[model samples]
Target: MSKIYQLVLHALGIASFSYSFSILHSLSKGESFFFSIHVISFLKNWFMVIAVPLEGLISILYWGILIYDEKLLFDKPRLPILIDLGFHLIPAICLWTDFLFFTKEFRKSHSHIFYLLLFAFSYAVWIQFYFIKFGTWPYPLLSKLESQQRVGFYFACFALCTGIYHMGAFVHTIFNKSLPVPTKQKDKAL
Candidate 1:
């Protein structure tokens, strides 16, 4: 049951990423992709509201395991969990930096990055799946690049995201961490 749940979670992550990527790619190329069926439309709607946020939450959990060496999720030296952590953390950082520093509205709302990262992360997963099943990468750069280079790219992305996460975490820690506690009397009066 645990294994099945893990597989479903991973599949959900992949599907959310793929759908976002397809939408972004189509938009970038000035094309339209439509969903005619209700199920497809429902999934797409939920991708933005639910799946993307879940991805960010998973990324934070990954970072907690990797950076803080938390043991709650898995035993130590679990290579697959480590690898999966790497996968989510890299793009999570990328999207955060792109939003916080590069874009206007996104700086105020970091959650926007969740959706953006989903697009890139999904593409990476799809490329990996292609490599695994057909033994060839769909993208020319990924296909032709040396194994070391590809590994480096993945790590580099992780490092970049770690930096951004720290920065964002710092900002939130300092500026946004505290909130006013409501009084019980005031609450009751309201």
Candidate 2:
């Protein structure tokens, strides 16, 4: 169950990463400087980008023992052998590599969970849009769930997102503890 959940999260991450990269690249190359504002704005400010990396952390921390019974790669021969690696493995590797080697301190706030939930909520809105357009839910879980149940599912996932954010913040703190967190204002004389 959680394997499928992570697979969905991974797909969302890939899509978000693609869109963000495309918009930024278009700007850098002067290809669509004026046309990608909406996309660029969302990628720059929205929490959509973090969903997968957070899930990736969850995968790494507890790949099979805690999250689910199945492994990330399906036991049955399904799709190409490496497709699972691309979707399930590489993204997590990239996320951890970037965090361990490149990310800056205090680059994110612990309070960013609200922003993350906002992004998830926005995705929920899109899920509704997709269902209306296609007359089917975007994912199997949503499809299996009734209207209110779907809402409950999303709320539970939002709570999960909140927890993921705190975990990410903790990891970031551990990785960056040596560096002083910058303050907007210094302490004054007392």
Candidate 3:
């Protein structure tokens, strides 16, 4: 189970949880002196660009596989209901909520596509290396796939993640547009 942290899903979940906690703590104190503004901004952008779409992908793929063929992901022992939801569902909801409602930094741009592609490719290499070193895949799905099939799977997932990112950006645009902007009230001049 120690190797579980190397799984992309677990890694992204950890990132999502950490980001949520960091944002909450920063908001509570009204200042983040620990990190410089540039570092904070970079981290925020990285999280929004890479982590958000990846989490969405993880959520969708995980639930889809779990529903379609549970045996593919697990053999006998199953995660508890809450633990499963915590791992597979809540990170997505939290990240998407933060992306849609609280964040305005995401915009439709080519750089986002680059970021997604970069992350997808990097993860593919990392997982391949892990498989080479460990004699077992992180997921049974990969173990069943041949080399070419795994490449295709990774490409398909990258495309899916790109689509998800664009969809989130589109929703963000429409949501922000529909929201009424706040206006300050003027005192009565008597």
Best by TM-score: 3
Window of ten residues with lowest summed lDDT in model 3: 24-33
Give the whole-model CA lDDT for all candidates, comma-separated.
0.48, 0.57, 0.78
True-structure Cα RMSD, model 2: 8.5
TM-score of every candidate: 0.33, 0.58, 0.82
Model 3 agreement with the true structure over 81-188: per-residue lDDT tens digits = 897887777878888887787766556789889988998999899888988899887788888999999999999999999999989888999877766789999999
Of the candidates shown, which would achieve the greatest lDDT relative to the real structure?
A: 3
Evaluate residue 123 in candidate 1 and report its C-alpha lDDT on the 0 to 100 scale.
46
Steric overlap count per candidate: 0, 0, 0
Flag regions of model 3 displaced more than 4 Å: 2-9, 17-32, 36-39, 178-190
Model 2 C-alpha lDDT per residue in residues 62-162, reported as the tens digit of each score = 34422453332334334453764665566666555444443443356554766667767986898788778768554444666788998997787677767
Screening candidate 3 with a backbone cut-off below 3 angstroms (N, C-alpha, C), the clashing residue pairs are: none
Look at candidate 1 and tell me the lDDT of residue 110. 52
TM-score of 3: 0.82
lDDT tens per residue, model 1, 1-190: 2332354367456544635643553344322345433434344443433333344555764566457644434433344765564556654554443323332211224553554455446646765776787675533345556878876755555445444544554554455444689877645654
**Who is ahead in lDDT, 2 or 3?**
3
Rank list by TM-score: 3, 2, 1
- Model 2 scores a C-alpha lDDT of 0.57
